[model samples]
Target: MDINMKKILLLGMGLSSVFLLSACSWIQPLPGAFNVALLEEKDVTGCTKLGTTTSSVLSHVGLYDRDTAAIKKDLILLAKNEAVNMRGDTIVAISPLQDGRMEFAIYDCVK
Candidate 1:
């Protein structure tokens, strides 16, 4: 009923809306574009091994927990980007690290 109480309620609603919207995927940073192939160690026989690449995803505070699928997707994209930078066509021996990171050996294949 009071003006002060109404203002406080409005401010609280505004803050709550901000927090809720911030948790949406649309508000998050866009995922990078890198479409490198994921291959096994034996599959890189004829491919020239470039080097190893590592990537990670950090957890953030949100109304809902971070999506593991999204995290893995981003990690894969990060690794592929690294492979692309290395002039590789595929990433071999891909492995997940204990620290929520991914490691892969980059390779350039002549197919």
Candidate 2:
């Protein structure tokens, strides 16, 4: 392969890697994790507040930035799994996402 061809091949591989990483999420929901619902704070009235959860994920996979929607979704999934660990059935976002981190309040509204 010529020098130019080798450089192009390396560049193509790097771009492909970035694209794959950006398109995929490393976070996976645990079993029964999705059973926990995300609700608005006002809607959780009368529910017992169990505790708080902080979920974080990689906002950028290397030089490629992940999609904002995907980051938000992953954060929610992690928070839901955490609510399950707390024996809660619902979660409310307590703060805006910042630096790939978010906070949520866990509640048991079904009881």
Give the candidate number with the greatest lDDT: 2
TM-score: which candidate is best?
Answer: 2
- Which runs in model 1 stand beyond 4 Å of their true positions? 1-34, 62-65
Candidate 1 structure lDDT: 0.68
lDDT of 2 by residue, 16-106 (tens): 9888777677777888888999999999999999999999999888878888888899999999999888899999999998988999999
Residue 93 error for model 2, in Å?
Answer: 0.8
Note each model's CA RMSD in angstroms. Answer: 5.1, 1.5
1-111, model 1: which lDDT tens digit per residue? 999999999989987776664444432322332457887898788988889987876534344344566557666677777777777878864676434477879888856
**Each prediction's whole-model lDDT (CA):** 0.68, 0.91
Q: Tell me the deviation in Å of residue 47 in model 2.
A: 1.2
In model 2, pairs of residues that clash are: none
**Cα distance off (Å), candidate 1, residue 97:** 4.5
